[model samples]
Target: MKYLLNSNNNILNKLKTKNTLLAFDLDGTLSPLVDDPSNAYIPDTTKCLLAKINKFKKYKVAIITGRSIASTKKILGELPLTIIGNHGLESFYAKIEEKEKWKKRCLILSSNLKDIFDQNEFFIENKKYSVSVHFIKKNRSNSTIKKLANTIKPLLVKNEAIILGKNVVNILPSNKSNKGFALKQIMKKYNLHQALFVGDDNTDESIFEIKKKDIIKIKIGMSRNSSATFYLKNQKEINSLLKLLNDVQTQGINFLCMNMD
Candidate 1:
């Protein structure tokens, strides 16, 4: 992936377009990854930049995350932006019955999976529509975690899907909905044609796969063979990127006004 710097004139030119959608992954993109997910919050500087962008008529901002809608809303605390949660299964404006159905299945799976591994070996997080088996806190060996995943993988039924990330395994309904689908839906709803998407993990890969010429895909940190076209050195760089976006939008608006004059 190419390093995204302010000197990249080509990218800066593309970002200046009106009707652009600015999408971000919440946990590792907008907020630093915390040991406890409940404590995550958007940095004040970044939040201010996002608020400014949201106020622009020609620009739209959104948060797309694997978090549940209610959880994301609670942390964000009232923002004029679209939120796509549960890896795209839940949204700010729509209620999905499938989420409730998946919650039941996840509970059952969590109970059965717990039987195979020692209860203290890992922690289970039930996110209503999805379940996450977290091995991070336990400090289990990599091989041990792999073995546990292998044992649980076979137990998944046809309608269930599993994705591995960092030291966690997430089980969710195997539906057509994902970050890519959610991004497309949001763009379509707003009649937007250009988008800048920033994310940090494998879950964000789906959004990177969207084959749109105007889509700017930015990965938060380094990864092997990431599909994103650009990379930010780390989460700390997210603030810099947001500031640049804010500057670009301000420039765009000033240019429009100058043209009118």
Candidate 2:
């Protein structure tokens, strides 16, 4: 409940223990944010680190984001870990296929809403399978956002869609979709005693606020008086962090085996 801000490597210390779950946001954290989100992919270093983590069955890796499950898989290419998508409205494990289908079907109405807005000439900007109406470029002014919200609110409500106001305005189906909810579900599913969340956007603050002592929050990119425990400047720093985690895991295992022998 109380907020804590920590340094860059504080969370890494927690991961020194075995059985840590590393959950990451897709865009702007694992992958750089681009004009188009769909094309975004994690850098080779990040991907390699993830594959290494997957080797230890005690540790679990999950990707939590606003993209659809199939879309997330499409971008990631090879899905070895669990994923929660459409914010937490959808969750898919490596073994389960039915839940993934159900979540996608539940979002079918969202596709219709997308078409409706497209017909109305509402400039859809953050279309990486996650649609957002960005008023940020039109001068980051509150009035611009307010005008767009006023125009779109009633239409979205009528269609059973909800507006998620972040750096931009996003209209999506009224599902309990958000990173906080998604993280909780993943934590429970994995029985995660200690975890770490790394993200770069305001939407990520939601999860950071709910974190327990073992679940530390990390912010990548601009630092602010946020719920994040630490901050990093760019993707390079994030890659470095992942590599550090991998090396720590490798060394710990070797130490344990030597002691046992």
Candidate 3:
């Protein structure tokens, strides 16, 4: 994988192509990962770049996150961009009353989880289609998450899955509706051929592991384990990417893009 902020490997030129989509994962990509998940927010510098990127006529900007749209909206602050939430489920878009049959099972799981964890210690967020059990590093013992998983595993029925994410445990109604699947759906709807996705954590891996060559995947943190083609050094380095994108649009590609090592 190449270092995104370190070198210009013609990746920006590829992104400038027609029918492109620029997408991000919120928590560790756009916003700093805080001890309390609810307090996470995109910094002013990053948010400003994202807003500018959204206005660019060449690409469609989107935020695909694990947070529910309701929660994402609270932190997103009214950016007129495409937002897909709950890893891929939200808004009850279907017409059939029978379509959301899994909600009842998820609700039961959510309720049962309450008995297993302390509300103060664990942040149990019920996103209707998924349930996330988050524990901060300082509060978590080695066996805490594992024991919790062991207990929850027994309760999982058909169509349910357990995903181990960064400092959190996620129970999804179905693993099929991930960021990669959601990104493809939007691409199909908009007829976008080129795409860029920036994310951190296991949930974002689906997007990184896509088989397409046109899709530029950048994992927030550099890791050989990830299938991403490039990576920004860390979450803080994301500003360099956003800045380059903004400059590419406003300052002309040749003038803004300087020689890189």
C-alpha root-mean-square deviation, candidate 2? 6.9
TM-score of 2: 0.74
Candidate 3 overall lDDT versus native: 0.79
Give a tens-digit lDDT track for model 1, residues 1-261. Answer: 877753533475567755888899998888888876778898777778778778877678999888887888887876867888877777643455666677788789878777876657677777777777877473456576667668778888886776666567777766566788899988998999999999988788999988887899999886776899988888888877776677676763222111100
How many clashes show up in model 2?
Answer: 1
* Ranked candidates (lDDT, high to low): 3, 1, 2
Model 3 lDDT, residue 42, Cα: 92
> lDDT of all the models against the reference?
0.77, 0.63, 0.79
Instruction: Name the best candidate (by lDDT).
Output: 3
Model 1, total clashes = 0
TM-score of each: 0.87, 0.74, 0.89
lDDT of model 1, residue 185: 87
Off by over 4 Å in 1: 92-95, 138-147, 252-261
Which tens-of-lDDT digit does each residue in 108-166 have in candidate 2?
A: 53455456555344445433234556542433555666676676666543333434443
Among these predicted structures, which one has the highest TM-score? 3
Q: Which of candidates 1 and 3 reaches a greater TM-score?
A: 3
